[model samples]
Target: MHNLYIPVIAILAAFAIIFGGQAISDSRVDDEIKSLISKQLGVDGEIELQAMKEVQKGYGVCGQYQVADQGQRFVPFYYSKVNERVTLDADAERYRRHCGS
Candidate 1:
């Protein structure tokens, strides 16, 4: 019975370690993504960060922000580290126009 318990505990421990590692990895990825997005968007001051669900793609962070002009109307943007690119959707053409390639 003790040996059976030991194996079960080992399996549980392994799973916990795997899950913890994954969580850490995910947090790091999120932080990096946030930093890149903020830089690209020229978000210097304190920002109300939000992850937009509608524009989200695999391994990318997508979101919108309301500028002084828009007054709570969020304009969409995309950030992807894999591609090292940030893109604003058509609705955000004003922002995109200012951001030269």
Candidate 2:
């Protein structure tokens, strides 16, 4: 009976760890990420996600927000990881300067 209880407790602990980690990472409104988005985009609010063909489409990592500059919008946009190393190319150098990364 004592041995059976040990296995039951171990299983419960494993489940708790798995689900707890998943819940934390899946949260949609992380303060740190939001602050970064706000700082980079120079705008803040709900991210626009118009489904109509003629409407503006918001894009971001994890599909959460728009990151384009006010006057520099473009289709097929791109975003680099905040921690990614800056490449030596002119475009990448410009990006690093623009984002202060």
Candidate 3:
């Protein structure tokens, strides 16, 4: 019963952001980025690819992804920024709380 609201909220939030963003990836780039993100999220092919591309920002190949069949619909996923200039560590507490990892 509680699982239904997540994707709905995600879809609604996507609509609000859809009009205010720039294109973030091309076909080839899409494949690469999705591969990286899927591994990072520990998924094989459960991500929403179209929505994945839409969420990435130009500043870096980073954005949120709508996870499928993972209980939570939206995951704020990211990777190193341009030129390896920035790298992020997972929030230990948050990971333990949400991901149990």
Candidate 4:
């Protein structure tokens, strides 16, 4: 089964590069994204971020945002590291286009 280990290792490595990179990138920008969301929404408390991945100029983030005690709203937002900005949009596809390549 030594041969079997090679494929398994390759698969595991691929997963690590794909997921691990995103995880690190997410943590680096999560706080800034949260702050921006809070400011834009004028909500207090925690802003939980879900899937965040590095895109072209920055990162594409989608998460549930709590507005006071009202409820949680699904928000699709983007953060451009180059521009140092956060954009909140209802449609992710549109946002992606606007965000550029």
**Per-model TM against the reference:** 0.57, 0.40, 0.39, 0.55
Clash pairs detected, candidate 4: none
Candidate 3, superposed: residue stretches over 4 Å from native:
1-25, 49-59, 79-101
Q: In angstroms, how far off is 91's CA in candidate 4?
A: 4.2
Q: What is the C-alpha lDDT of each candidate?
A: 0.58, 0.41, 0.49, 0.68
Kindly list the per-residue Cα lDDT of model 4 for residues 6-59, writing each as its tens digit: 999999999999999988966777878888888887877777776565666443
Runs in model 4 with CA error above 4 Å? 1-26, 57-69, 91-94, 98-101
* Ten-residue region with minimum lDDT total, candidate 1: 92-101
Q: For candidate 1, write residues 1-101 as lDDT tens digits.
A: 77799889999999999999988976675566556656766765433445553223355556654444335566566555467565656455533443322
What is candidate 2's local distance difference test score? 0.41
State which candidate has the highest lDDT: 4
Number of the predicted model whose TM-score against the real structure is largest: 1
Looking at model 3, residue 16 earns an lDDT score of 68
Clashes of each: 0, 0, 0, 0
The per-prediction CA RMSD against the true structure, in angstroms, equals 6.4, 10.3, 14.5, 5.7
Cα deviation in Å at residue 48, candidate 3? 1.8
Local distance difference test, candidate 4: 0.68
Off by over 4 Å in 2: 43-60, 66-101
lDDT-best of 1 and 3? 1
lDDT per residue for candidate 3 within 9-83, as digits (tens), equals: 999999767744423435555556566666765777666543332222454444456656665655554433344
Cα deviation in Å at residue 55, candidate 2? 25
Model 4 deviation from the true structure expressed as Cα RMSD, one decimal place = 5.7
The CA lDDT at 83 in model 2 is: 52
